[model samples]
Target: MDKDFWLTKWASNRIGFHSTDVNPLLIEYWPALSPKGDEHVLVPLCGKSEDLVWLASKHQKVIGVELSEIAVRAFFAEHFYLPLVTHIDSSHVYYEFDELEIYQGDVFTAPLSGVDLIYDRAALVSIAPSQRYAYAQRLCSLLKPGGRILLITVDYVQDELAGPPFSVDAEQVQQLFPGMKTMLLCRQEADQHHPKIARQNLTRFADEVWLIEA
Candidate 1:
């Protein structure tokens, strides 16, 4: 998908993929990373996720990169804080509230060389299949050596569906992060009662979380 796809999604309020609360998976799995105070964590395709606010509340510095300006603006606005604006190359930097900073531009173009940890809940799977390899390589380059990456992906049989919420199984994740030690932390069928996925015709859907060390 191109930038316009996401921009339109945000503009039209077509963000069913956006979670209403901090993801339970993140709550249960993130502490395992043991992020230290002042260390920077990268959240790619962050949108207006409350998870960033949750992380920041714990004294961790958060750098979130998003493609949609609407999502970026909504994030700061909804939080009742204004950002310190700056331009960086092709992206616009919005830094505010001391804890969170967002880059409004393509994630591939955002500078991420110094990121301590990568926390991706919706980033990777949201990209189309043709872009997954490039996205993975960019992620690797952005992460520090020995740094950790926390990824959440979905597995389902409905490959025919046109999706921004794409399907990515464990094997694909392994191939994508070949240089890192990849371990599955959790895997369970997504709740059928979940309002978002309930309408899908698929028999079963699984959420798999992986911990990758660079």
Candidate 2:
């Protein structure tokens, strides 16, 4: 997807991908990773997700990278926060409640260091297929050794539809991070009866939760 594609989505409020609540899979598997105090967690392509707020409550520093300014603003606005804004290189930083910081720019172009954990729910699969490897390399580079990543991906037939939420099988993920210790945390078929899937005419969809240790 191009920058204009996402920018238009945010501009028109066409964000069906944005969940209203924290993801249940994250809640279920996060403790297994055993993140410690004040450790920084990175959220790539984070589109004003409520999960960041949930992580912040656990006393973890949350850093989210988003491409759209509108989505970034909506995150703080909807949460009733007025973030302390600053400019860092080509990106804009929005810090709020002393726990969360969102950077608005391309994730590859952003400067980041000291990331201890990664929470990837919709990020990896959202990118174009050709870009997934580059995205994974960038993500792996940000992590400190012994750090972990909680990655979520979808599996389905891609010929049926166009995607901002693309389909990525487990093998591709393993190939992306070749030497890392990757484990399949969970795999469950998504509820096809739901209105969301109905719109897409998706016959089958499955979610794969992965734990990556460096």
Q: In each prediction, how many residue pairs overlap at the backbone (N, C-alpha, C within less than 3 A)?
A: 0, 0
lDDT of 2 by residue, 138-160 (tens): 99999999999999998878887
Prediction 2 global C-alpha lDDT: 0.87
For candidate 1, what is the lDDT?
0.84
Using all chains and alpha carbons, the TM-scores for the candidates as numbered come to 0.92, 0.93
lDDT of 1 at 119: 92
**In model 1, which regions exceed 4 Å deviation?**
89-91, 191-198
Predictions in order: lDDT: 0.84, 0.87
Which regions of candidate 2 fall more than 4 Å away from where they truly are? 94-96, 191-203
